[model samples]
Target: MPENFAYPVGLRLQGRRVVVLGAGQVAQRRLPALIAAGADILLVSPSATPSVEAMADAGELRWERRRYRSGDFEGAWYALITTDDPEANAAASAEAEARRVWCVRSDDADAASAWTPATGRSEGVTVAVLTGQDPRRSAAVRDAVVEGLRDGSLAAPHRRSRTPGVALVGGGPGDPDLITVRGRRLLAEADVVIADRLGPRDLLDELPPHVEVIDAAKIPYGRFMAQEAINNALIEHARAGKAVVRLKGGDPFVFGRGMEEAQALAEAGIACTVVPGISSSISVPGAAGIPVTHRGVAHEFTVVSGHVAPEDPASLVDWSALARLRGTLVLLMAVEKIGRIAEALMAHGRDAGTPVAVVQEGTTAAQRRVDATLGTVAETVAAEGVRPPAVIVIGDVVAVGA
Candidate 1:
């Protein structure tokens, strides 16, 4: 965090009285932290925003539900004066001064006896940055430090102990930044990472030099790693007391075969944590300026895997039923069989001219959208040289908010 002369220190306010003079935006913003700190909050405001009122209704704070009164800070260890009326704010600050209680004046920071530092916590560590003058800069610095710590960029080179287990992390739609904070933190602590070709490939570049990365790519109609081999690798490393991360693309459970890995870990008696990611089913369409379900345009949406052709005996999807729905359809892993899928949809009951939009490599630098209809989407995709890792959107909602 950035340096300052504010002499930052954290106050232990658990079960202690803390007075707040207003319940407007500032109070609404600051009250939650106080409540989380286990402070006994006394809110003196005639009215509050719906959010603040709900907090009061839930008994999170003691709300007087009236204008500020003299001696409101009599039993308070800390006071926050934020009323709309300058006179009320000044009076509360003066009372707090006479009582020798520390106070923060939101209306006039210069007159306040205390300043609130931008604060954040990660991995059992509390970080506070105080810039007395630039609250925005303080917040930015605090965020940077916390992010670095969580991503292991600032982690110590050696640790007294290491956590041995396996984590199934959903890397999220090919964007490194889209990975969850918890997932990133786990990756930073990992000794080995088993990654997929379709996962957030960029994140692999950020791993430390000592971290081992294994390509567990399951390329379509190409080179791949057998499921048994991948499972064995995970169990083997974990049994050797190494921290392992199985990084997959999109949601681990959304056709990513995450449960299979989890079950494998369970049978091996290895601890496994599964972290979900943003699936392309909805996010991909939104990235390409399409809403899967727009009011009146689409009342519902269905997601299906098109890896198997409609005529294939292994296919479980009911093409006829899907065609009868007057909503949206999202297909994943269907680029290889889009022609057959489109034919089945049109042959059943769906309109041949239904609007369609295919987003390739959604949420990445190479993302591109190809527009067509159910009647010609296959041809359009082929003519445009579209490839796998694309999201297919079919419905009137495709054009509702385009």
Candidate 2:
């Protein structure tokens, strides 16, 4: 862990040869960031996407327009391969490592020299989210966390101590870079941190090496610590005159049982505060470039959980009304119930052919999305191999592509 490390610090790449092996949209996404950071790009691809061609024509990059060669990475400081071919990406990583040049493998996590966080730049401050495990997930959380700060919902940590209250912070969907500047600042100054199982671990690396972190997150179908015990631990730590942070995955207040912990702290006469983080309901799809609302396509958007207990009546959403509503429907943790959700919506009069987009690890470098009509979305997702912690956006607006 490192404290107060200045990030977004520009690395001088003015005269460096940086090879990018891919000309698809994924490769294009990395170009702007690298170029902005002053890397002289050498793009190697047999074919180029429109975006890549534009950059090459503008002299921002030198194009080879061919398959990779053994000497492709000669004298390169960094190499990035965003091709769909995992073998090529792996080969590039292996070669770069052997040459002692850093490489970022687009498709494999274990093969990257530098992981890209989902980042937002403002007024010279760059905020990035890292999962420490999944760079792509970090991207999603990063988007939501930045949104939380920009929307004026969270504040940076101050030196006040006497009445220091507990703030249950949400780190956003999955991106570690998504944590707020205020949140990151708070993390830097925190005396103790009690984090959730779903929160990104890369954020932990930003803390001072001396800071104490307690993993108090719950696990499903396991011998897990009770919530009451966790709440008690938070209060006890804060009462000892320490600035405590209870970190969650998405918006802490959403489904993280934050209110219960807040209530418990209040009952103990301990100071408490709240820092809102990004919620998957909106930011997840947005990261996948799917807007939840559009002028004529969707007038409203709704989000609901699909993981509540069977006995919880509130978990049962009004499918009939949702189907008839002229708006976007975003489902969190609904991958397991895709068939049921589609059936309910269709049975309740929603068009079977309504557009749908399933986004996994949205907004991160590893983001993957599958676009299909409602009638085919489930099958498409399965065929495309989309996984959990995903969002399903259903409506006419799914037809839009970035």
**Predictions: Cα RMSD each:** 3.1, 16.3
Q: What is the Å distance of residue 134 in model 2 from its true position?
A: 42
Model 2, global lDDT: 0.78
**Candidate 1 lDDT trough over 10 residues, lowest sum:** 217-226
TM-scores, in order shown?
A: 0.92, 0.57
Candidate 2: tens digits of C-alpha lDDT, residues 1-402:
653222343356777889999999888888998888778789999998898899999998999988887778889998888888777777778889889987777687566776666788643456876666665677778777765555323444444454555778888877887876556656666788898877767788767767789888542324435787788888888888888888888888887898999999999998877878888778888888788888877889888776642234655677778889988888888887787778778888999989888888775677888888888877887888888878889987787654
Q: Model 1: per-residue lDDT, tens digit, 1-402?
A: 543356667999999999998899999989999999999999999999999999999999999989988988988999998888998888888889999999998888888889888889987788999888788999999999999988887875445686688999999988788889889998988999999889999999988899999998542323435877788889989999999999999989999999999999999999999989989898889988999988878899999999999999999999999999999999999998999999999999899999999999999999999999999998999999999899999999888866
RMSD of candidate 2 to the truth, in angstroms, is 16.3
Which numbered prediction scores highest in lDDT against the true structure? 1
At residue 299, candidate 2 shows an lDDT of 85
